[model samples]
Target: MDVTKKKVLNGYHVIFLVQNVMIGMSLLSLNNSLSAVGYSQWWFPILFGIIANITLIPMVWLSLQYKDDDLFDIHEKLLGKWIGKFLNTFLIIYAVVLFSAIIQHYLDLIQISVLPERKITGHLILFILLTVFIVKGGIKSLARFCILTFFLMGWIVYFLRWGIMYGEVSHLLPLFNFSSSEFWEAFRNGYNSMIGYEFLMFFFPYIIHPQKAFKHASIGIWITILFYLSVTIVGAMYFSEWQLENLFFPILKLFQAVDLTFVERIDTFGITIWVFLILTTAGAYLWMAKKGIDSVREKNSNYHIYAVAIFTYIIINLPFTQVMKETLYEKDFYVSYGLILWPTVLCIVHLVRWKKKEVV
Candidate 1:
């Protein structure tokens, strides 16, 4: 269908899509994840941002090579059909698992914090329906939704001022205090927050200004980095080392610092609003998974979206043990990290093919 010709996503869409996707469930617990470095964790998002930008270069470079082809199509062209399809199967699985993981994690948090008395089944069903609706509209629709989510949810950052006002500035001192092992531990644990930027590989074909995409996407990333940095710095300043280490979602604790008259339980309010971020993140993955299914079957159909959504629903609802679920959702991020780096391998393949063509 030459989907690239239908590119409707502008630079702002690219920016917001990159930003919102990276801002999902992870932000809530990001401080906890980076607790290995103690107070020094405030700058970790910057480190993550730097790594994300470096990795971003290869992805954008590869996408520029085939302006009309997404990562799935690029795989087929570069590696040949059978091998590419084999690799794409794993990509599809990665997308589905990631979509399921983000949804499950958010729903679980809601159960713990807001709807503890209620079973998550209702929440799960509602979330899937909303996600399916967003993905069904396709990438342009999803991009618009991402833009809306960014504006709507971006205001919540203002609430962090309460924590900043009350927190001690001295907590940010003793910089670089962590050992080398601790830095590595913090990096490993917190890198998941940076995962969404890689989806740029999947959507690059739809960008209206592909050349400016790197600039726009970089802006989006730094915006998220600044947001994360603000929250982490406030968290470091506001909480004790024990709280930073033990509180599962320190941002929620930061939320408790809000002493407003009209708003009671602002944390719960924040969690409720978080559904928008979750929707955009899951919607992007679901859309990519649907595209993967279409590429595999060599047909375009709305049913692909539904099929992936159903599969995601079942995967999340499965009665796996807590440990098993954690392993699948948390530990399986190696697939995402691999996807981020996969473009470098493809770039090498591209150069070889170019040389061979020249020799011919």
Candidate 2:
């Protein structure tokens, strides 16, 4: 591999990459999703941040062990080629399904919240084409795009102050009143917002500073946590318990509170600008799927990228009922939980094998 083409990501790119990936469409629904815990739900994002940090350790450790390989290659190294190929195929499918789900959910939101007349297939086609363009330039290009997305979409946070001003401080009271079941339910419901950080496992080899990767990645995760925490807190304060439970995209409702005289219906603009965040997310997954294909073939080619992108494009465009689509997307949450545990299991396997070899 050419040096120019490989090992190009620095610390901040890694940081922003993780941050942008973690903060996606899920941020909009997160407050509503966690409303099960009511006023105390503000702290759930902090819990997610802690979990994100912990799950990240095994992934980072495993990647540092094979500095040149992504998780797909690491899977083959840790398992025999045949078993690894099987698992890798499954992982590729997971990536494509995940990509489809994210795109579908985002497009659905756009259709419902912003652009009602446009065909979903039209939006998906344009989105996937743009994503393929980014993915084709390879991971470095994708990382740079993520950086751009962070700067572009991040200012939306400033709008939260409007929600805060209209919010009642009393809604934030009785913060610890939730039971364990409510907390667990809220945690599970909100965990999907934290899903994208695991993409780090697949892109770790590109990081120039693997030794400090954890620190930088943690910073990114914390940045996401800060945004999530702020939004959740503001949302808790802003919406009544019943309103929080009912609003599908609480962030959009938050945007509605903004008193911008020049731009009426700011959420319409928010959804339009939010395309970058969705692109960053869907592009990352598409790249990972492409990488998995390349790993299986033992070579790199743009054909794999196009194939996966097309597959994803088709998957989302399929005429599944809304109920079916929701079910499929819901399944991804469990699949993601499995992906998080996967690294820790692999690390344990590696450690055991090393120990036996040392003893021998």
Candidate 3:
């Protein structure tokens, strides 16, 4: 019963995946959302983001101890086979639904900004088809794609800061305008934008260098939080709260507002860079969904399942609409039900089972 892995993407690849996965299109709307919660104290979410990762360190360690078993397998070992299967099913659905919603939102932005009259369904199909083709290449190709995005992330951040030198500082005035509860509430809900961290459960087993995963994931979380905090601060300073709350892409809006002597349209440039970041994030989730299937007994399941799931996502989002997308964010905090609570409880039960077996 030796289960061999067909997915060959390694640890170096995981580093890139870590960077790419967190830099989602939502990075643009963070400030606007924070503002909606009536808080200019933007550091609160950044602090919570750091703390959340620290809290998950035990889960990370327990995951590594299993010789690279993904969360699904770990669940199966502790919970019964049926219960594990049910959880995995929910995870698959969760990823597909959540990412589909994301794709639709981005497509909504492009349609409104780039082509006001273009149909989203066709564009969504074409875009998701592109995503599927890439995933079909399997883990190695996906990992390499992620590596490319890491460089993109670094350069884009540098360009954004350097390119927009003329941004207004007054926009950031009266930073302490909101109450403590309002700030913390916004921070707690905003954690969903940092949603990709949960994928480590599926990806840890595939990591070519398992030993570095905890360290790398830790560093990755810190870097992502810093980037997010910086982006929020920049957006906060560049755009008024009302403008941000209504704008689909606040980061791009900030760029659009800037007028340096040499550059007339930093916003267009920002959108272009965003395409790469968004594609990488979407692709990483598709890959993780595929990898989650690797946890099953059938060794080759991930390779095929990933492709199928991508096509399925295409169907779900192809006819997607722009209405009430914020409703998804409503459930953002609710993800704790699955991502944190369920996994944490299962991990403890797993340890108890392991200890009892050792005694026997």
For residues 239-292, what per-residue lDDT tens digits would candidate 3 score against the true structure? 666776687567776566555788777776676557666777777667656655
Displacement of residue 238 (Cα, Å) in model 3 is 2.4
Instruction: Tell me each candidate's TM-score.
Output: 0.98, 0.97, 0.84
Give lDDT tens digits, candidate 1, residues 217-253: 9999999999999989999999888998999999998
**Top-TM-score structure, candidate number:** 1
The ten-residue window of minimal lDDT in model 2 covers 1-10
- Count the clashes in each prediction: 0, 0, 0
lDDT of 2 by residue, 223-259 (tens): 9999999999999989888888999898898898899
Clashing pairs in 3: none
Which consecutive 10 residues in model 1 have the weakest lDDT in total? 1-10
lDDT preference between candidates 2 and 3, better one: 2
Pick the winner on lDDT between candidates 1 and 3. 1
